[model samples]
Target: MDLINTCFEMCDYIEQNGVVRLAGNVKLRDNLKKELLHFLIYISMTDGRYGEEEKAFIKKKLGFDVSASMAADIKNRNMLGAGYITRVPETFKYFILANAGHKIKNDRYDNKEARTLAETYRKLGQEYLAANTGSTEVEINVLSSYCVMLDENLKSYGLLRPDYKSVAIQAETADEKEPDADELIAELNSLTGLTAVKEDVNALINLLKVQKMREQMGMKQTSVNKHLVFMGNPGTGKTTVARLLARIYKAIGAISKGHLVEVDRSGLVCGYIGQTASKTAEVIESALGGVLFIDEAYTLTNGKGQGDFGQEAVDTLLKGMEDHRDDLVVIVAGYTELMEEFLDSNPGLRSRFNKFINFEDYTAEEEVEILINNCKKQEYMLSRDALEEARRFFTERVANKPEGYANARDVRNYLEKAISNQASRIVGLKDVDKNILAMLEKEDLVGIEL
Candidate 1:
């Protein structure tokens, strides 16, 4: 059977199970249930081997306590059997028909939801290879490709699709091989002033090399722990690092694709009731096989009372994290205290994200380096005296300012203003000499002075 059809079958069975109803007569949308079941199956088959580990992972994902009876039932059924088998019952035929009914009847199917269901379906079908299906065989690689199609179908609903390309689903090609060292170095050079941050990221690159080697050796490599939290003040290169990390992740095969999709409060949240989950799920769908960076993620819990849409966003985000664990890497960035509150607000959030990279406030010397780098990019040369003056000005006026206002961003603003001021001093003068240029200066740095 095609993977999409198999996914529908699994969804139907899962939704009909007695345990499914135990969550109460809660109106679980058919689309949502189908997508959730699809994710459960995907994580279980992570190593391309479906066994006890897959079952345990499924149970956790579905929020089920694996009882003895549940264990016995899974064993009897062909759910987690090794290799592929096509013994799915005829009764399961209703699922495919029912799913098809929605499309045939009105054609009012939300492609967003359909795409999500499709993704889950494609993943399940790809992972669970039947033991032996004769000479007319289906390959897991082919099935993974189908999942990408569904991802595109679902993404048609978004306002503007991201520019990054999705990785091809070919088992002949392994994801996460060693990246070109030169490319990695070029990217590192583009970033500035965070020596420690650069080193940490390089370490992750080396780790990926080791992981790729293990995969080549036929050893069960430890799952790449891709989860990370960026703890830092603003403009300290957290987001830049995240974008680079996505490329590295793709290069090393942590996810299927290495795109960077950014969203803050506006993307995943909704003010109305019953809408946040769908909204969040849609965002997750777009970010599959990529990095989903949530800047100021702590603000997602703002506002007073249960009516706050922020909480819904959080709930929705956590759900997506669990469902799309194998396909995406989420990086939440915000100030230290706010991030603390964010972690405290959700147990699942705290548990899944274990790696934290702290971005410290830049020192005076580092701030000077940053300004010089910015100056070079802007094609402006600051005289030695002007540069020293700008650095001293920033030290007194920006960095020493109050906690909420101090950051590398503030330093950049200072440099921009100084450049502007120096430019303004050199109006319509055709042949400005080096001596005249050397004397350029700014009355004050950019941004409000302390």
Candidate 2:
């Protein structure tokens, strides 16, 4: 895989903050290489399958095939992380995480075994896959899981990411290219709808700027809670706005790094008793210097009562918020009524999150603008008739909008369906017409049900 080649390139030749040096050149005396191989095997079998794609990849790099017993051991054992990698030294810790920390099903993480330099990539991969799935949702993304682990490790090791092309530094890529406060605010204001949300964000930004200036002038300022509550339905750009806010905080030096770590109750509350606190703490640690955007935070306090362990997570989260008050901002979002109930359920939650911003549903015209924007992003165009049809479709849909309608998300689904319809119609054509391929006709939109 190309990733493996990049890792090799990094091993043979690399530069760290202007100093060029060869990494992984130090000799090792542990069973790190074999442990690393086993960790790779565990990640490859994550989805309950280890096909030829995985088998061949492992064999080529490790110089041996994964035996049947090894595969079974991976499946039978809880995971390969806790017992293998977290206890290693910084040299191997950095090496493992940089090379094998992240994985996607379609993407491959390949690297040669360089014993002289270091042979401990599996540690990162193992730490990532070490989340106790026994008590969490099955759909929790492996990539996100591993990424959170990698971030915690990076913070502990005091390391900075070199490049996005390098797997070891995946956490810092977003920050490296992040826009400043003005640019982020401009982007937020440029969204199709959410006029009220825009005004609210602007007012908050102004307040912070004045507060900073007052501090410079030796004027004592009251404590301001950076945490907020977002009241809106799904897909109303809550997460998007929260992400922009993170960068804005960083650009203004309110936070150390401006990364947004998004998670819901599923990412926080563990099924086990004492485990929930640690799990919640780990998630908070990853979000130390950024915003933690918790969607559907209402679920955590939905009358599940003390037995649910959701309360434990909430307690841990509150402690983390206070402990890292200077650097972390927490944004909890849900439907208007449910969010009210969530806040009502806890006194501390109500006190800490006094600022509330409501994201209104998009109007029909705004939905059409969103459609056009989506098309323009992918180099697709809607014919005049198609655009008019989209307008009518959204107008009627908005007039009779159902409960829990996902605003821009609905537009995205319609555009994707239109593309699929266009492909189906053009597939039988004898010649490939660039114009036909690029344009969405009226019938394409007409055929879409939503």
* Tens-digit per-residue lDDT, 357-416, candidate 2: 999888999889788878877778999999999999999889998765688899989999
lDDT of 1 by residue, 117-180 (tens): 4434433442333211110122333333333333333333321122221122112256554443
Taking the candidates one at a time, how many backbone clashes does each contain? Answer: 8, 5
Assess each prediction's global lDDT (C-alpha) against the native.
Answer: 0.57, 0.66
Q: Lowest summed-lDDT stretch of 10 residues in model 2?
A: 131-140
| Candidate 2 Cα errors over 4 Å, as ranges | 1-178
* Candidate 1 CA-lDDT value: 0.57
lDDT of 1 at 179: 46
lDDT of 2: 0.66
Candidate 2 has what TM-score? Answer: 0.61
For each candidate, what TM-score against the reference?
0.56, 0.61
Kindly report which residue pairs in candidate 1 clash with one another.
Answer: 84-129, 84-130, 84-131, 85-130, 85-131, 175-253, 176-252, 176-253
Error of 2 at 280 (Å): 0.5
